[model samples]
Every structure is written in structure tokens, then in C-alpha cells.
Target: MAGPGAYAAVWEPGRQNVTRYRLTPRGWPEGRRLRLAILSDLHVGSLHVPLSRVSELVAATNALAPDLTLLLGDFVASRARIASDPSLADLATELARLQARDGVFAVLGNHDWWHDEPTQQLRQGPTQVGLALERVGIPVLENKAVRLDTAGGPLWLAGLGDQIAFLSRGRRPRGIDDLAGTMAQITDDEAPVIMMAHEPDVFARMPDRVTLTLSGHTHGGQVRFLGWAPIVPSRYGNRYAYGHVREAGRDLVVSGGIGTSQLPIRFGIPPEIVLIELG
Candidate 1:
């Protein structure tokens, strides 16, 4: 009776899981392995994802014992029809708890760009969410790339600006992302690259040098049924809507993510944090 309704409305939306994957990408070093914890679409302060939930997920991510943790933006719940949500500062406190051996890095999502009127108006500078994360020691990369020395080898981490950043408002829609610029920042030619992009739609254009691409924006339909999400925010529909995809020797992983977008309801997909073991 009440069980089914509760499962759909509150229980499913409130739960969190760690979805794991192990991949040996084309450019990954032969004997080296990197355990990465990837969190996306946090949409913190949404209906189910409160400060408490964020704290819990941070604890959960740390427990995964990841060598690296990556956040793929949308930390703010700009579109959720909630009465109230936690402040950006409060959300940062919990996110700061996330630990990774190589440190945690992040990229902005469309919602993050859409949420900030000032940034959207100026079409530059860090958003409120970016400042919040950076203050807590989490570096927010927008059209930037950085190199990290790892046991496996030197790994290049590249992150792009939100693709649909200027989708809304009266302004004509366009992406602020500069894939070419971000890729050019990698001075080293041989190191394997791992790119964090908010939308999986960018994977198609990635160069052959990248070892793996990680993304989250669809929220696994945020209301999936039978493993398929009918409504994905991407241009390609369900093609890159979710899960690990291998195309033309490039590896891409799209996280279902932990929070809802437009509506605060999740049915089959639930909420999740993605963990990838890449070598």
C-alpha cells in the first residue's frame, strides 16, 4: 500500500549508492592502476540531497578509499522546486571532507552557470559555487588542465566549461567551453589524459590522446524505468544518457549522479556516486 508510494517518492530519492567500474583505457599505463571516485550532479540542497546527505556521501566517498576524487559539477539545485536548500557555504563544508590521495578536482555544470546571475551576466569569472569549492581547497577547473604525478605515471586532468552554460535567460544559447584550449594546456605529450566534462556530448570530439572521459548531467533520466531514461538533457538523446561507453577506442563514463534536476523524483535509477578504477 504505502510502501510503493514511499519507495518512489521519498525512499528511492533519498538513497545513495556507489556504482563501480574497472577500465583499462587505450592510453593507460600497462601496470599502473588509479582508483577514482567520481561524483556529479550533486544538486546539493535538492529535495533529497540535504547537507546531511552530502555529509553522508562525503563519508561514503572517503570510505571508497579512492586514490583520486573528481566532482563533475551541478553542485547547486537551481531548478528543483524546493522550499529551501542549503547555502553554498554550508555545502562546501561537507564537500571539503571528500578526500583523495591525489586531491579532489572539479568542473562546472550547466546548472551552476545558470544559477549565478552575476556570472551569467558577465559571462566570466567564477560562480558562487566555484568560489565556495575553491575556498575549501577543491580546485574548480573551467577550461583548464592540470598535470598530476601518480604512481602509474603522470596523468593529465582536463576539465571544460559547461556546454549549455548560456542555454537560458534572454541571451542566445552558446557554450563557453574551450576543448582545444584545455587540451593544449597539457604540455606533456605522452601522459594519459582523463577529462572531466559535465555533458557526455563532448566525448565525440575528444582527441585520440585521452584515456578516459567522465561526465554527468542526465541524472540517469532522474526517473528511469527498466534501465532506460526517456528524458535525457543531452542532444544525442539516450545515446550518451548513462553508463560506460566505448567508442572508437575512447572510453567514457556517464554517471547517473546523486541528485535530481527539474523534478525531485527518482524511480528506478535511484541516486549514485560513480567510482572508476582506471589503468
Candidate 2:
């Protein structure tokens, strides 16, 4: 007989849900309404996320017809390399089907950098998944920001490098994320900023200039008991583990994220494709 642990690890993680949240950030344009689709930590080729699941992900996203779609990285499964999974080319091919009015953008996560030895070793340039994303017409934002003209007004989208990229560099796990450099890329001083970071720990120092920040990597702790994540990978513990958070008048939404990491089990928190409406 299969116990609940087995179901949490095997059966439940594969089920996907479309979770929705609404937020009106401090600087969000009054007349502008934006719908965003956030896909995070797919962990393709993981125990539950197979190559075939990409199509399903893309299809579900398109049906929503969001104003913008963001991929929050971790394309490869943990404890494995991109070469071991379905080829990046194959994964990108399906991701290409995603459509958003403002277009789709992406950023690399810890797993993406850790698994791609070439990129991690170099400690610079695009990761294997980043290149694949670009080839399929998705913009990979690496410590970079872009200005988008929206009906509400102009908005700045900034993407940061993974906070923990290399496993070891001089006895410390070095990250490529550049918060200051990324913030400096923004030329629009008035437009509201939305940051995409793979890790949520940055929320503590998140400047008031940014209206909203989106993150993943914790996977809502992959398991929660009565809304408490017993094992959060973040330095802040459960402070930024999951769900929408508002601190000091700024907003941060951490999706439960798809797939599992470190351990392939999910209870109380299932995989989800986040649809956020901002006005």
C-alpha cells in the first residue's frame, strides 16, 4: 500500500494548479491593468517533471493570455546536469509556444548555474539554459533591466543572477547576482520597477524604489504543515518562504513553484503556475 509520503513525493507533485493573486503596488499605474504569468522552478527532467510536461505548461500559460510571462529559472533538476535531462534545445522548443502581449522573459536560478559546469566555471556570460531561452526568442535577463512601455505608463523589469551560482569558489558558494548593478541599469527614475530574483532572501534589502519583486527557489518549502514550512532553504527561514508578502509598503510574491528540489516531496503545498493581476 502506498503511504501519504509516497503520494506526496510521487503523485501529488506532478499535478499542476493555476493559482491567482491580485496586487496593486504603490507605484502601479492607476489606469493600467497588467496580468502576469509566473513560471518558476520547473526543474525539467526532475523526478516528476518530464520533458513532455513542458508542452502542458506552455499550453496552460497561453490560455491565460497574460500581459507578460516570466520564467524564474531552475530549468534543470537538482543533483543533475542539463546534459542529463531532455536536451535544452528540446525544452526551449516547447517553451517557444508561450505567448504574452509584452512578450516572455527569463532569468537563471541556482540549479541552472550549478548544473551547467561551463557557465558556472566561467562565472560569467550566459548559462546553457539562458542561451536556449534566447534562441527560442525569450529574453534572458542577467543582472540586467529592460523598460517596457505599458498602457499605465512605463515599467522597468530587472533580472538578477542566481544568488548561489557556484557551489564553491574559495570555500564559499559564490553568487553572480548584482543588486546594485541591476538597479543602476534602470534609466527610468519614475517608472515602477519589478524585479525577478531566483531567491527571495533579497526582499529584506529590497529598496523602496521597486514597486514589486517576484521570486522562487523555496518551492514553498516543498512541504508545509498548517502553513508552516519546516525546512526553508532561505537564510531568513520562513519569512520569505512562500506566498504574497507586503513589507514596508512594497510587495513580493513568491510562488509555490513547480517541481521539488533537494527532496521530491510536496505536502500542503502543491506545484503551481502563478497568475498575478497588478493594477
Which predicted model would earn the best TM-score?
A: 2
Model 1, residue 11: distance off in Å is 1.6
TM-score of 2: 0.95
If scored against the real structure, what TM-score would every candidate get? 0.94, 0.95
- Per residue, candidate 1 scores C-alpha lDDT tens digits across 1-279 of 688777877889888888989999997888998999999998887778778888889999999989889999999885732557788888888899988888899998988888788876887767888999999899998999999997566899899988888755686567889999999899977899999999999998989988899999988777777777889888888888889999999999999999887777788887888888876
lDDT by residue (1-279, candidate 2, tens digit) is 469878897878988999999889998878788899999999988888998888999999999989899999888888766456798999998999999988899998998888877876677756888899899899999899999985456799999888888888478678888999999988866888999999999899988999999999999998898989999999999999999999989899998998888888898899999999987
Segments in model 1 whose C-alpha atoms lie over 4 Å from true places: 1-5, 80-83, 168-172
Candidate 1 — which pairs collide? Answer: none
What's the lDDT for residue 220 in model 2? 95
Each model's RMSD to truth, in Å? Answer: 2.0, 1.6
